[model samples]
Target chain A: MKKRGIGIGSIFYGTGYGNGFPDVSKAVAQLKSDGKIAIYVGATEVGQGAKTALSQIAAEVLGLSVDDIVFINEDTSITPDSGTAAASRQTYNTGNAIKLACEKLKRDILEVAKDYLGLNSIVGLTLKNGYVYPKTLPEKRVSLGEISESLESSLKEEAVFTAQTTEMDEETGQGAPYWPYTFSACGVEVEVDTETGRVEIIRAVLAQDVGRAINPELIEGQIDGGFAMGAGYALYEDLKIEKGKIKNNSFTNYLIPTSLDMPDIEKVIIEDPESTAPYGAKGIGEPVMIPVAPAILNAIYDAVGVRMTEIPVTPEKLLKAIKEKEMTYNEGKN
Target chain B: MKKIKLTVNKKEYMLEIKEDTRLIDLLRDVLGFTGVKEGCGEGECGACTVIMDGDIVNSCLVLAFQADGKEIITIEGVESEEEIHPIQQAFLDVGAVQCGFCTPGMILSAKALLDKNPSPTREEIRAAISGNLCRCTGYNKIVDAIERAALYLKRGK
Candidate 1:
């Protein structure tokens, strides 16, 4: 016989290393003569779409499309230090740096465009589609190609942003350690096999507070990937260690969820907006996986009346718990 | 050491190899098809997947000598210089390539499946690429990319 139950889990996570720790990230934006914008930073992209999101941020700031921003990253010698790509800080930290650099570049371009357009006041002027022109005057526009020809060399702007945080008192162990916090909630449905203690996830639904979604598709990808990892953590990704040496260290022993292992997933994106974050967007790289394990565990308890404290919730452990519960009931009746 | 003749990406190569050399090493190190990534180096992760004689096999598990007189299709040969393969294009348009370590094998698996079926249901597509391990995008977009690729292939675009 198989019993089914649904469980819910929620969490609030603070992105970036906080607690009065100085968190800084840097970026340099160069306006190429060909009218392409090159963004230089040291943020590593491990397939989490940091480069795409960062480029979107730059594009948002400079009134350019994502295609116009030539995103360059992960080179230490050429690009400046953008810190490590941890704590979900790349979007929040380095994104701000890129935003600032593009803003400066925009100002410089407008300065040159004012002279090219023969405008005394550069107030009504803006950049769009490789042209610098007044908002009202579409006819009196100068292309970026013409703007670059008048310049002696290409224009560049470098900027840096420090995350705001304060150290806590040692005794109290409290302070404003992290900024731009994010929250998420998850619901999971599972079927627990009473005969063999097998558990299967039927469906999963998650609602994430992503401050703002710079790239909605990328966010969807992140949430889906996070759920797979969380499912693995809740089910069967156990690493064996002996004498501090790891056994089952490779994929042959350790396993992750394949496409067949995943259930139907529904993602709900909540965009409340963070004022301090770039384009009012927060980092969700690490927070999306926080709710999956607890929800699955709770669902298992609901179905089979077993509160599995350990991960993997293997059949052996679940069956032992069920047998013990049955014995306690049978003995008490006598 | 042994001598083997194989067709890779429609190119014929007659090469001498050690009896112990795996096809992955031959494709990556010797043939310089670095697109054939070796993730697990074992048969579990299908990162070294290549199409051999119309079947998808883990190149890491296949010895170089086993490929003698066989036809192999790798990521490098998926498209011509002028146009990208529809599957690769769909992977890009759907934003399925993340970290991209598992892409070469994943794409080859999709290619083999489409070459056989041309119009696979979502479940069949899932079953086809289940051996490839991608920790980045989960499997949602990759699955969607394959479905989209099927549309492109059916339309003969």
Candidate 2:
């Protein structure tokens, strides 16, 4: 017998090392003499598209396309510290550092533009298409290359972004910790086979609040990947341990979602901007996966009216639970 | 060690392999074809997938001696000098690559499917590449990439 049910799960996650930990990131933006911009930050890209997102942020501030910015190769010796990539902090912490640095760098470039264009004030001057010009008169313009040549040296600006948070009380464990918290809500439809204890996800939709979407495509990809991991964690992965030794250590027995196993995924982006965040964009990496397991578990309970407490809900365990429930129901009938 | 003759990426190589060497070792260690990734030594992950005689096989499970007179195609052979394969281009255009650990295998599996059936439905594409696993980008974008690759291939023809 097969049964189906739909369930929803919602959660909130705080980005960075929360609980009163210091969260800080620094970035250096350079206006190179070659009329291009270079940004140096120690933010490692672990396939979450951190580099791309950061590059987009820097480019937006300078009114240039993504290609105009030269993203310096991240090296500890050459770049400022943007903190670790964990806790979904790269997009917010490093993004803010890059954004603040670029703002300062923009001001530095405008000073040269004001003098080069012989303008009384930089109030009406703006940088666009590799040139600085007045909004009213596009003809009275000076190229960035000319400004760089006039300076005879590159202009550098660095900025540090730190989050303000307070630790919890010693006994009550209550405090407003972690900054720029992200939230998400997920709905999943699943089918549970009573005889075999197989839970197949039919469809999954995640509505996430990304604070702001620096890159919508990358955020969608992250949501899909995170949901797949959550589904696997809820139904398939079985890491057995005995006497301090890990059994099923390899991927052979521990299964992950394959192309056929993944269900239809629909991403819904809910951008409720954070005032303090860079470009009002927050990290969606950790929060996307937080609500998936609970949703799947709830869907399983909804389908067969059985309360499942543990993870994976493997076939054997599900079948046993089903049988016990049936026995209890028959006894009550008698 | 026995000498075995095989054609890889349109190039012929006559190599000597130990009896205990796996096909992956022959390709990666001996021939320096490191594109075939081995996520698991067992045949489950399909990370070491390659085309052998027009069929996709996990190189990790095949013995080197068994591939004596076979023709194999690894990820290194998928691109030409002028441009990458249409499938590779489609993967990029569709945002199907992330971390790229499983990309080589996924591309090869998709290649094998397209070669056999130029026009595949979404279900068929899923069934064909079910053996390969990708943790990033999920499978949606990869499937979309393959569908787009099919279109590109037809237009080029």
Candidates' C-alpha lDDT: 0.91, 0.91
Instruction: Report lDDT (Cα) of residue A332, candidate 2.
Output: 100
True interface contacts reproduced by each model, as a fraction?
0.72, 0.72
Q: Give one digit per residue, the lDDT tens place, for model 2 in A176-267.
A: 88887889999999999999988999999999999999999899889989998898888888888999999888777888888888886899
Report the TM-score of chain B alone for all candidates: 0.98, 0.98
Worst 10 residues of 2 chain B by lDDT: B132-141
Write candidate 1's Cα lDDT for A301-321 as tens digits. 899787888888777888889
What would the TM-scores of all predictions be?
A: 0.96, 0.96
DockQ of 2: 0.77
Shift of residue B52 alpha carbon in model 1, Å: 0.9
Please report, as a residue range, the 10-residue window in candidate 2 chain A with the lowest summed lDDT.
A248-257
